[model samples]
Target: MLPFAIGALRAIVEMLGLCLLGMGAMALLAGAGRQGNPVYRLFELITRAPRQLVARLLPGRERPLLAGVLCFLLLFLLWLALAAWRAALA
Candidate 1:
């Protein structure tokens, strides 16, 4: 049971990391030009939810990429802590 819970937590952390990476990348691309690029379109579509949520949270923030970078750094540190805790439990 403990192992299963740890595995689930790891999976969730990995997914969150991926989501943050994608959001940060997309936000960075939003500046160079948003049209005529399918990759940008796809990323924009995929990251819509979290980006919008972040935008709402920080209304005065003028740059989405900066926001994404901060979020990624925060989540990365959190993931490291979770990984360490899981290793200790194991």
Candidate 2:
């Protein structure tokens, strides 16, 4: 059980790190004005799908910074939820 908890914590940390790295990459691309590039479009399709969906449901034009931050928060929340579920199951 202890090992399992440690593994879960490690996975959560790694996920959060990846999310931060991805957010940084997105910001760099946005800053470089490459948002229209095919690679960026593919990235948006793969990574930012949920943000895009939510933006469509909301009013006003999409803001990359805001969307990225929200996505990071959502990912963090997902990690927390997973950790909690694991703990409960244990």
Candidate 3:
């Protein structure tokens, strides 16, 4: 059960990281008009939670791209920690 929970968490973190990557790509492709693109909006919506969390840690400014990158790194660290825990359980 513990291993299963860790795996689930790892999956979630991995997914969020992917979403952030996709969001960044979309932003690049869509330019300043990304807000009007559905795909971009979807990625943005999915990554919003992590960005908001990072925003609180950052303090000042509306730097979404920077927040997204920081969020991705944080999620990657979390995923690595969960993997290590799961390996120990195994």
Candidate 4:
């Protein structure tokens, strides 16, 4: 029971982190589209690192919506994996 509680807590924390990361990425991408300023570029570089890595491995053009869906899928998978790990440990 204690192990289950701990696992749930860990999963919640991880979900929050992933949500924040996804939101930050979206914000940076939004900034990248703005005209007449380079400030967004810095954020774009930071947030784009993961997407760039994915793109490199996947090797394809991805639409914004598709990217968003992928993020959601990845987060969901992470949550599921964590939950499964917790259950197994218990």
TM-scores for all candidates: the values are 0.57, 0.55, 0.92, 0.43
State the weakest 10-residue window (summed lDDT) of model 4: 35-44
TM-score of 4: 0.43
Mind giving the per-residue lDDT tens digits that candidate 2 earns over 1-90?
A: 765875677586555547556657866757777566665566555555666654565566557566656666766777777677776767
Give the winner by TM-score: 3 or 4.
3
Candidate 1 per-residue lDDT over residues 1-90, each given as its tens digit: 776776787776566568667645655667556555676566566556656666667757687766666656655776787778778888
- Arrange candidates, best TM-score first: 3, 1, 2, 4
Say which prediction, candidate 1 or candidate 4, comes out ahead on TM-score: 1
User: Which residue pairs show collisions in model 4?
Assistant: none
* lDDT of prediction 2: 0.63
lDDT of model 4 at residue 51?
Answer: 50
lDDT of every model, 2 decimals? 0.66, 0.63, 0.86, 0.57
4-52 in candidate 4: lDDT tens per residue?
A: 7767766664654465465556566666454344544453444465455
**Top candidate when judged by lDDT against the true structure:** 3
